[model samples]
Structure formats: structure tokens, C-alpha cells
Target chain A: MEFDLIERIRRHTEVNRDDVVEGIGDDAAIVAVPSGRELAIAVDTLVEGVHFPAGTAPADIGWKALAVNLSDLAAMGATPAWALLALTTPDGDEAFFDGLARGFAELATPYRLALVGGDTTRGPLTVTVAVHGFTAPGEALLRSGARVGDVVMVTGTLGDAAAGLRCLAEPDASAYAALVERLNRPTPRVSAGQALRGIATACIDVSDGLVADLGHICAASGVGADIDAEMLPRSSALLTHFADADALDFALAGGDDYELCFTVPADRAGEVGATLARLGCGAARVGRIVEDAGVRVFDARGNLYEPARAGWNHFAA
Target chain B: MEFDLIERIRRHTEVNRDDVVEGIGDDAAIVAVPSGRELAIAVDTLVEGVHFPAGTAPADIGWKALAVNLSDLAAMGATPAWALLALTTPDGDEAFFDGLARGFAELATPYRLALVGGDTTRGPLTVTVAVHGFTAPGEALLRSGARVGDVVMVTGTLGDAAAGLRCLAEPDASAYAALVERLNRPTPRVSAGQALRGIATACIDVSDGLVADLGHICAASGVGADIDAEMLPRSSALLTHFADADALDFALAGGDDYELCFTVPADRAGEVGATLARLGCGAARVGRIVEDAGVRVFDARGNLYEPARAGWNHFAA
Candidate 1:
């Protein structure tokens, strides 16, 4: 039965790519990657309840699983090529498989990403996606290159997804369908990342909120950041639904937003914004890399503010 | 925190590979693949209580996880290079993390396979390993290359692992320590697989019993096979532990063995056996590919024989 589901997935996710020599149905997939280019590989796992909430649709679960991994590739300034999925389900239901496969393909098709192989096993619902992408040797972005005085920027709007999560907890959630969709199906900044390949000094996808993710770049680059909270780009919908304080909290430290929080030279920020704007993701200059030791946000009066939480920590009790 | 465990895992599993531009501790891993080789990728997932019995040591669980994926690379006649791990655990214990990392590194050190990237999530214990290896262009051993007149052979002994599982359930299983070791850790036939790359027409690793794995080859190659039951190889320990009929049944249909089952032209069977013997794994020619559509066996008296079960089915209740 698992094999049958995999067969159906193979048919739906198959892409006619010249580099793929052998796809699903083999012991291993064979691919001919172009030489001289560096491969960017990442793996991300989403548990049914931990990574996503209960009552989440199978299609959303599947899309988020792949999207998060793709986001990692995007942060590396790599163009995705192929992916392998390891899916463990409590019950191997056809309906669940169909919905998940459809969602996976829905995101994968736009990128021409081929589902080269996958394995389905019996267990609690969990989806692990491993993606392979490519970048020109010297152009691949890294989180360790942001020097002091560099600027930290983010793509697209923020806080919508986390606000969407909050909306789901209330009885009037249907009014926030757009926010719910953002929480469910995040748009990985693939094209924007590719455009920022040589321009961005450091890059990271914001899965664990702005402050926490920027902290990663800060830690990795041996620098710190100071951002103005008023400059955060929040969706009008997010602001309209939540109170100002909650909306600011969600925007500053709300995890689950799949936006790209990256660093570029302060002088190049303008052109970088133009490039991302051309890609349709729209970039925002939210902070400046500093010589300090941590990421700190300044309120309207330049006073330091603390969030309810730093970010999502997997093992935190 | 998961990062602390991942830090320890990173320290233990880190390998010095020039191909690895970045290994773990970044948004994504950057690897430089050498030109003139095709990449072979495979993933396998092992869930606690499903893939292995409860109370199995964490070290054994970790070793078996990577070993299973390495077996797939061996079947593809590819040289293992790098791997990514996605581990989900219910309780992130320090002891469990240490043991698992130790075991993973113990097996990985031999092949020089580097742990390039990984994600640790909070959930029921499950390990998903994605391995990448390489083979020369057009030299890959595939399951679809078997010819009607090809000779079918297998490496090492079969059914030991399955018998080992049975031994674990019995109180007097102490007498069968060797069998139990086989169940816990089956050696991947990597060297033997590489040796057969140019000579073997088709290849697959025996995971879900000899018959089931062989059936995979036949289905892919569009051919059938016939084997003599008496020609099947058996270990002295296995023979001593069980009745001849029970031993044969286990050899034919018992699963969990990580041996390599490959096909070669009848004319090259002798050289193939000699080459495998040089690798110390040895080989036995037990069958021949045929024009029929399904695999069948003949006993010593020329009577047809049927197994109690064809093989393990993941979703079969």
C-alpha cells in the first residue's frame, strides 16, 4: 500500500529534467549534476503537532515540509534542483497521501523541482524533506560574512503567519483566512535569494522569527544588530486583526515566518532592494549590523524592548 | 537544547573532506562534487517499535539507520561520500544522543562519509538518513539491466538477521549471540558492490527477504528467475541453531538481511564469484534469470516449493 502511494506520488511529482538519470523505483536515484557549481543541501523535519498545529490539513503539512527545506536552500543563494521525501504516517490513508502529494507538487512545480525519490514508513505523522540545489562557486551566500556596519534586510511582509497561528486559537478565525494561509503555505524566497547571490554578504531564512534568525547571522558573522521596531514590515491584515502590542510582538519575535533575513553592504542596500523588488518579494532594511554582541531592537523612543520569547527552540521545555 | 546535542553530534561526526565546503552549522550545507561522476542518492527511515523492537540500544539504532542507507548505495555500486540526518526524538536525553552519535561515527569513519547537514526535531524517535554516493557515468548497477539468461548471485549469508530477531525473543537466546549481532548490525557489502560494478548486469540489496528483493529486480528488468533450493548458501551457525526446513524457509523468505543480490551473464559467473571471494564476502550462484514472469524454486526431488510469506509489506497488517 505504501508502494502504491509512492507510485502515485512518482507520477505526479515527476519532472522531465535532463540531469536526472534514474528517478523513483530504484534503490537509489542517479543524477548528473553540472560540474564547477557547489551543491547546497538541507534537510528539515516537521512533526504533525510540534512543527505544525493539530487539525492542519495534510496538503498544508506537505507544502510546509518542502517549503521549509527549500527556504534553507534559498538562504544559501542556491537554485533548487531535486528533493527526496521521507514520510512516516500513523495510518497509510489514500486520502492523506493524495492531499500531501498534491501539496508537494503544487510548490515543486513552480520551481521545476523533481521529486527524485522518497520512502514511506509506518509511524506518527512526520515529514522530512531533503533538498539539493546549486550555486556558482563564489556566489553562494553564507551567514558568516556579515561584517560590522552591514545592513540587515528582510524580504516580503512579516508577522502574518504567527498572527495566523494566534487567529486559529480563537472562535473568529475564519475572518483571518489570508493570515491562516500564510501560516499554512509559506512562500519560500527562491528567486529573491538567487538574485542576492553575490550581493548579500550573509543570508538566513526566518523560520524562528526576525530577532532570533538575525541573531544567527550575528553570531555566525561575529557581529550584532540593532533594528528599529517601527521599520518592520507587517501586513495590513495582520495589523488590522491583532492589537498593536501583539502585532509588534509577533513581528519582532514571532516564529514561523518563512521570510529571508539577510545582510548586505550598507552602500549596496538600495540596489539590493531594487533587485528583490524586481523578483516581486520586496526587501526591507530593518537593521544595521553592529559591533555589539547580540540582536537588540529599539522602540520608537530608542529604548530596548524584550520579546515574550526569543524564538522557537526545539528542545526548550 | 537540541542545538547542544547537535553540537556534540557535529563534533563527533565531523570529517575532513575537501569536497565539503560547509558541513553542518549553517542554513544549508555547501558541497563541491567532483566532475565526471553521476550522483546516487537514497533515503531510508527507521521508526522505533516499527522498524526495530523497543528497548533496542540507541547505538545500534543509529548504526542500523546509516547502515541501511549505505546498503542502498552499495546496491547502486556507488562509493559513499556524504550524508544528511533528520532525527526526531521524544525525549532528548544526553546519554541517547552520545550513544547514537558514537555508533553513527563508528560506521561512518570506515567509509569516510561526512555528516554534512541535519535537523533534530521533537517527536517520536525516528531517524531518516539521506546518503549521496557516486559512480562513473554509465557504470552504475541498476535493477533494470538483468537479461533473461543472466546468472543470479548473492553476497554473504542470508536469513541470519531474521533468525537473530527470533533468537532475541527466546530466553535461551544467549547461545545465539552471533545471530543476535547479525540482527543488530548487518554489514553493508560496499566493497563487493564496487567490485561488481562493471561485471554485474543488475543489482539490488536484500532488505525485505531474498525473494522480495529478487522480485524487485525481476519486476524492473522485465524478466523472471528460477533457483535450486539446495544451492542456497547457509552458515554453519544458522544450520546448527535450527532444523534444515526451518533454516531453508528463513533463507528464502526471511527479511532484514543487508546482503547484495546481483545478476551477471552466465559466462562471467565464475569470475564474479572469484572477484567477490577476493573481497572476503564470497558469492554463491543460486539461480538463473529466465523468460518467465515470476520467480519459482525447485526442491531436490524436482518438486515446486512455495514460501510461507513472500516478504515484508510495510502497510500490510
Candidate 2:
């Protein structure tokens, strides 16, 4: 059964270049480490109950497993090259596992990310993907690079994913299909991240709501933030679906937005904005770093609204 | 509860200056890419019903998950540096999860490995560990580098894990206590693996029994092996507990032996053996690589013993 599933996944992807040495179907993968590149490795595990709603589509689940790990690499301004999947599923259907693997392979192929190794086991539905990427030695954009007075920016919009989740929880409500798709299939900003390689002072992906994830960057970089709420990028699609009370709250604290949030020096902000525009992604000058170590959000009237205590905490109720 | 567990594990070992930039408690681990080093990464997942018997202790499961992934990194002759753990368990007992994490953290600390980052979820008992190690650039040992005339050697004893499993399968039986320990905590050859840095030609860790794992090395290196039954590493503890037929068969095909099986030039055998001994490890020459494509084992009377057709296929019954 595993063999049959493996065969199905193998058919969809093109194996280019011999540098992979060995791809899949081995005890472990063997890849040629090109000389003079720093390897960036990260692993992410998404279980059925914690990372997504139970009984989510296997295809979406597979796509998300790879997407979240790729998001980590993207935060480092690294170009992803290969991945290893350790997938655990209930041992019932060979075709189901095949579908999941095929979905993963389909997304990976276009990105030139080779599925070099994986392990399949029988258990509850869980997917752990380890990604390998490369960057010029010592050139990764870290969360510690942000400085006081650096202008904080975010690529693309936020709050869409959190709103999508709310829609999923209450599916009877009418909403735009694109918002729901954003919740299910987030596009990792790989190219935009690579473009920010030398320019961005600090970077991170907005996984746990914008406010929460940016707090990580601020804490690591030892800086504070004053976000101008009115300047946040809002999609007509998101505002239309959640234009009601506290819709802005979803944008502020909604997790699962796989967009890149980074900091740029004031002098480099224009160039970075132009670069992102050329890449067809919208950029928002949402905030600026401060010498203090607290994050504050201000409305156009300069009044601060109380932030919600809920962000996505897996272990908490 | 997670905080308490992390503190307990953190107290067991100290971090070294060479292996970490930031350890634990971060968005992701920030590791320094050492000059002239290439990173080797591997991930493995263990599910309750799939990888072990039902009702296995969480502590043992924790040990095995990290051990198996460490075994993979050892195969590359890479020095262990950091690990990320993804654990899914029923949320009823926070203590259970904490115990499991403590066991993993304690085991990892002695190897100079830090718990970098991980995700936890509520689900069936599943543990996935992603290990990251570093070796001098272009110096990692590969399974595909074995030569036809090289001597195949295994560090420490084989089949201890399988023997331990037999005891676990029938706990009331009169098996020795040492065999059970072997099954529960199969120590990976970390030191021997590091020592083989410049000596061994090709290496792989024995996880899925000797025959099945050596088959992997053989397929990768485009060579075969001729193993001698008389020279096989057999535990007297196993002999005392099993019928001759079962013991020998289990010794031949039992899985989960976390020992290093590597090939070295015949002329380097003495040096490799002496080197392992200096590190307090047992290095036994058990076979020779052959030009043929399949593994062949000879019994004590010089009669050839072919492995069973169905050898340790996890997907197959």
C-alpha cells in the first residue's frame, strides 16, 4: 500500500539535476551540499487538533504542512531547496495517503523544492516537515537585526487567515471564497523574502497573529513598536466579509497570516517598498521601532484600543 | 507544566560555546553556521501503534524517538548539535507530556544538543524528532561511498533491541533485565560516529534490523554484503531467553538496533577497531562488501541462509 502511494506521488514531480544524489525511497536522504552556502534547516509539525480543524481536507493539510515550514525559511530570507516529510496517518486507505503526498509534491515541484526523503507511519493524522534551504554564508536576516527607529513593514495583507478561520467555525455565514482560501492555502512569500536578503534589518512570518509575531521580532531585536492602525493594509475582500464590529481586531490579532513582516531602515524604506511593488506584493508602513520595549497601537485619532488577549496559544485553553 | 519540564531538562546539562547561538525559548533556534561546516538534518516519527507495541511508556517512546533520529545523523558522521521535537498526545495528562519532554531533553543535553524549537498538539501519542548536526564541509560520510572490497563492521552488539522487544512482548517471561533495557533505551553511537569522521568509507545506522538496514547501504552504494553468521554479535542474554530457532532468526531480522553499521577499507579495519575501542565501543568485523547486488549470509556450517522474503515492511503486515 505504501509502495502504491509512493508510486502515485512519484509520477507528478519532475526530478531535475543530479545534485540530489538520492531522492526519496531511502533510509535517509543523501544530497550534495554545495560548497560555500550556509544551510538553513527548520522543522514544523502540524497535528490534526492543534494546527487545523479536525477532518480538514487531506490535500489542504498536506499543503499546509509544507507551507508552514517554508514560511520559516522565508523568514530567514533563504531559498528553499529540499524537504523531508515524516507523515503519520491512520492506517486505513492507501489512496488517501497518496492524495496527501501528491498534493504536497504538486506544490513543491513549482518551487524547485525536491522531496528528498520522508517516513510514513501509522497513527493519528500528523505531518512533520523538515526543510533545507541555503543562503550566502552569514547573510540570513534574523529577528535580532531590528534597531530603534527602523520602520516596520509587512508584505501583503493580514487578518485574512484569522477571519477565514472564523468563517470555517461558522460556515453558514456568507463570506468571500477568497478569504476562506487564504485560510486554507497561504502563499509563502519566498521570492519577496529572497529579495529582502541584504536589505531588511529583521524579518519574521505572521503565523501567530500580526501583533503576537511582531512582538517576537521586537523582543528579539530589543526594540518597541508603535503601529499606526490606519496604515495597515486591508483587502476589500477582508473588510467586506468582516466590516462589522472589531473586524479590525481580527486583522490585528488574527494568526495564520503567512505574510512576511520585516523592518527596514528609514533610508531604505522607499527602495524596499519599490522592490516589493515590483514583485506584485503590497507593502504597508504599519509601524516604527522605538527605544522602549512595549508594543502600542494607535487609531487615527491617537487613542489606543485595548488589544485582545487571545492570539493563538496551542497549549492554553 | 512545559516550563517545569524545560527547567528540569535544562538543569541536566550545560550548553557549549561552539554549538549554539540561542537555545530554547524563541520563535526558532538561532544557530551560528560554523565556518567550513555543512549541516546534516534528519527527521523521524514514532507513533504508538505503529512504531511500538500498544501501551508503551511515554518515557521509552521519548527516548526511542530521539535515538532513531540521532542514529540517522550519526550515519553521516556529523556531530550532534541541536534537535526539535514535535509531540502529539491526549491533553488529559499534562504530566505525561512533561515527562516525555523531560526524557528527551535530558538525553539530548549530554550530546551537546539543545532543544531548539518544536510544536506540540493534542492527538494520539506521536513523537517526531528532527535532528541537526554539523560536519566539516564536504566531509560527511554517505552510504553510497562503500567500495566492493571494503570490510563491513558494526559497532557494539546487534539485535539487542529486537531481543528487548521479545521480552516486552512477553513481559512475564524469564528474559534478562539487561535485554529489556536494551530495547527501551538503545544508545546511539554518537562518540564512535564522531570518531569515524575521517576513517570510515561509508556508514548507516541499523534501525530496521541488520539485514534490512544493510540492504539500504547496499542499494545506495551499488554493492552487496556477505555476512557470516558465526561472527554475528549475539547476546548471551538473548540466547538464554529464546529458543535457538527464534533467537537466531530474530538476531538476523530483528529491527530497531541503533548501532552503526559501516564499511571501511580492509586495510583500515585494525585502525577503525582500535579507534572505536579507545572510545569504549565494540567494533566487530562481521562481513565484507561484495560485487553482487543482494545480501548473502552464511551459517556456522558454511551453509548460506537467505533472508525471508517479507523483511520488516512497515506498511505490510
Candidate 3:
């Protein structure tokens, strides 16, 4: 029965690529990478009650699964190529599989990412996606290259996904359709990441909120950052639904925002911003890299700011 | 807490290599694939009650997860290189993580496989591993290359894992230590697969029963196979633990063998067998590819044989 459901998924999400010598229906997938190109690989898993609410749609779960992995590839400035999915559901839920395949295809088709191979098994609702992308040797972005006096920037708006989740839990909070959409389906900044390939000193995706992910950059690059909290980009939808303090808090520490947060040399900040603007991403220079060794946030008055929670920690909960 | 567990895993299983531009602690891992080599990728998932018994040790679970994925790579005649693990536990179980990491390192160290990038989530007990290997371009052994008159073969003894599983269920069933070990830690036939690279026409790993997996080769290659039940190799451990009929049934239809089922041309069967023998894994000639398009088994009396179950079906249970 699981095999039959896998066949259903295979039919809905097949890609024909010359380089993919073998796609599905094999013990393993065989793909030819162009000469001199390095492979960038990432994997992410989403659980039912942990990553999403229990009543979330199957299609939304599928989209979020691939979206999170693609965000990782984007953070590395790699071109998406292939993906493998390991899906577990209660028994063989054919309807759920169909909906999930459609959702996966919705995100995968635009990137030209092929679903090469994977496994389907019986268990709690979970989706694990492993994405493979290509980058020119020595060109992929890393979190360990941030230098002192660099400018910190972020693409898209923050706190929308977290706000969306709040709205999902409390429908009376606000009925902002756009925020809900952002929560259900994130737009991975693939093109913007490619645009910043040579410009950004270090990069990471804002998965565990802006502050925590940026802290990763500081730790890896042996540098620190000071963020101007007032400079954080906020969408009109977020402002309409949330008050200033709540929205700022969510933007600072709430997780599940699949936006790219990166650092660029102070001299190249304009070029990076202009490039992202041309791509229609419109990044914001929210902070600056410092010589200190941890992330610090300051309000508009230059006073240190703290939040109730830094970000989502799986075990801390 | 998840991050701390990941740190422990990183410390326990770190592979330092010049080719690995980046390893763990990154959003994605960057590895240089040598020029002129194609990558072979495969993924497998194991669930608590579905894939194994509930009380199985954490170390064994980790070993089996990586071993199954390596088996897929072995079936393609690919040399193991890197792997990504997505582990979901009910909570951040530190002891379980340590035991699992140790078990994973045991199998990974021999192949020099690096633990690259992955995600740790909070959910039911699940382990999903995606492995990446390298093979010479156009040299991967696929399941769609078997030809008529080719000799069907398998590496290692059959029925040991199945018989061992029985022993696990009923501890009173003949105390065969080897059988229990085979069920808990099935060795992946990587060396034998490499040895059969040019000699075998087609290949697949026996994760499902021999009949089911061989049937896959037949369906892919548009051919049939006829196996002689008497020719099936039975380990002394399996034979001592099970009666003749039960042992034969287990060999034919019981799963989890992790042996390579392949086909070599009739003229080169002797050469292929000699190569595997040199690799310390003897080959068994239990069947032959035919012009028909389904797998059939014949008993010693020359009559057709059928078992109660062809193999495990995840959803059927």
C-alpha cells in the first residue's frame, strides 16, 4: 500500500532532465554534476505539532517542508537542483499524499528542482526534505566570513510568519490573509542570494528568528553585531495587525521567518542593496558588524533592548 | 537543547577532510565532487514501531538507519562519501543521542563517510538518513540492465536476518547469537558491490525479500527469473534456529537481508563469483534470467512454490 502511494506521488512529481540519468524507480538516484562545481547539500525535518499546528493542511505542510530546505540552499547562495523527500504519515493516507505532492510540486516546479528519490513509511505525520544544489568552487556563501565593520542586511520583512501563526491560533486576533499566506508558504530568496554571492561577507537564513540566526554568524565568524531594532523592515500587513511593541518583539525573536540575513563589507553595502533592489527584494540595512562577540540590540534611543524569548528552541520547550 | 545535542553528535562523529569545505554547524554542507564523477544519492527512513520493535536499543537504531541507506548506495556500486541525518525524538534525549551517534560512527568510520548537515526535531522517534556517494560517470549498476541468459546471484547468506528477527520476537527460539546479530546489525555488502561493478549486468539490494527485490529487476529489465529453491544459501545459524520449511520460507520472502541481488552474463558468472570470493563474500547462483516477465520459484520436486508473504508492506500492518 505504501508502494502504491509512492507511485501516486511519483506520477505527480516527476521531472525530465538530461543530467538526471536516473530519477525515481531506482535504488538510488544518479545525477551528473558539471565539472568543477561543488555540491551544496541540506536537510530539514518538520513535525506535526512542533513545526506546524495539528490541523494544518497537508498541502501547506508539504510546501513548508521543501520551502525550509530551499531556504537553506538560498542561504548558501547555491542554485537549487534536486531534492529527496522522506515522508511519514499514519498508515497510507492516499488523500494526504496527493495533497502533499501537489504542494511540493507547487514550490519545486518554479525552481526546476527535481524530486529525484526518497522513501515513504508509516509513522506520525512528518516530512523530511534533503536538497542538493550547485555552486562554483569557492563561491558559495559561508557564515564564517563576516569581518568587523561590515554592514548587516536582511531581505523581505520579518515577524510576518510568526504573526501569521499567532493569527492561526487565535482567529479573533486579526484576519490578515497575506500574513497567513506568508506563514503557510515562504518565498525563499534564491535570486537575491545569487545576487549577493560576491557581495555578502557572510550569510544565513532567518529560520530561528533574526537575532538567533545572526548570532550564529557572529559565533562562526568570530565577530559581533549591533542591530538598530527600529530599522527592522515591517510589512503593512504586520503593522495593521500588530501593535508596535508586539510586532517588534516578534520581529526580533519569534522564529519561522525564511528570510535571508547577511553581512556585507561597509564599502559594498550600497552595491548589495542596489542589486537586491533590482531583483525587487529590497533589503534593509538593519545593523552593523562589530568586534564584540555576541548579538546586541538597541532601541532608537540607543538603549539596550531585551526580549522575553530569543527564538524557538526545540528542547527548551 | 537540540543545538547542544547536535554539538555532541558533531564532536562524536567529525571527519576532517580537505575536500570538505564546510561540514556540520552550517546551514548546508559544501563538498567538492571530483571532476568527471557523478553523484549517487539515496535516502531511507526508520520509525519506532514500524521499522523496528519498540524496545530496540538506540545504538542499533542508528546503525540500521545508516546501514540501510549505505545498502542503497552499494546496490548502485557507488563509493560512500557523505551523509545527512534527520533525527526526531519525543524530546531531546541526550543519552539516546550519544548512543545513536556512537552507533552511526561505528559504520561510518570504516568507509570514511562524513557526517555533513542535518536537522534535529521534536517528534516521534524517527531517523531519516540521506547518503551521497560518488561513482564514475555512466558506470552505476542499475536494475534495468539484466538480460536474458544472465545468471542471477546474491552475496552473503540469506534468511539469517529474518530468522534473527524471529529470535528477537521469541527469545526462547534457539539461542543463536549470530542470527540475532544479523537481525540487529546487518552488514552492507559494499565491497562485494564494488567487486561486481563491471561484471554484473544489473543489481539491487535485498531490503525487501529476495523474490520481491528480484522481481523489481525483472520488471525493470523486461525479463523473468526462475529460481531453484534448493540452491538458496542458508546460514548455519539460520538452519539451526529454524526448521527446513520455515528456513526456506524466510530465505525466499522474509526481508531485511541487506544482501546485493545482481545478475551477471552466463559466460562471466565464474569470473564474478571469483571476484566476490576474493572480497571475502561468497556469491550464490540461485536463479537465472529468462525471457518471460515475472519471478517464479521451483521447489526441489520441480513444482512451483509460493510463500505466505512475499515481503513486508509498511501500510499492510
Best by lDDT: 1
Give lDDT for model 2.
Answer: 0.76
Q: Lowest summed lDDT over 10 consecutive residues: which window, candidate 3 chain B? A: B308-317
Computed on C-alphas against the true complex, the DockQ of each candidate is 0.91, 0.37, 0.90
Q: What TM-score should be assigned to candidate 1?
A: 0.98
- TM-scores for all candidates: the values are 0.98, 0.85, 0.97
DockQ of 3: 0.90
Candidate 2 fnat reads 0.31
lDDT of 2 by residue, B1-317 (tens): 33334444444434665545545544345566566666677778888766777776667777888888888888888788777777676764756665676667667878868776666656777888888777775577777788899999999877666767667657474446788777767788888888887788888888777787787789888999999877877788877777766666666677777889999999999999999989886799989999999788898788998655335543232
Interface RMSD of each: 0.6, 2.8, 0.6
Clashes of each: 0, 2, 0
How do the residues A1-317 of candidate 3 rate in per-residue lDDT, one tens digit apiece? Answer: 54566667777777777779888888999998887788899999999888888878888988999999999999999999999999998867678888999998898988889998989888898999999999998889999999999999999899998888888767464467789888889889999988888889899999898999999999999999999999999899999989999899889887888999999988888888888889887899999999999999999999999966778653242
Clashing pairs in 3: none
Order of candidate numbers by lDDT, starting with the best: 1, 3, 2
lDDT of 1 by residue, B1-317 (tens): 54567778878787899999888888899888788988999999999887788888888988999999999999999999999989999888889988998889989999999999898988999999999998999998999999999999999998888778888879898899888888778899999989998899999998888888898899999999998888888888799999888788778887778999999999999999999999999999989999897889889987988976678552241
Docking class of 2: acceptable
Candidates sorted by DockQ, best first: 1, 3, 2
Off by over 4 Å in 1: A314-317, B314-317
Chain B TM-score, candidates in order:
0.97, 0.91, 0.97
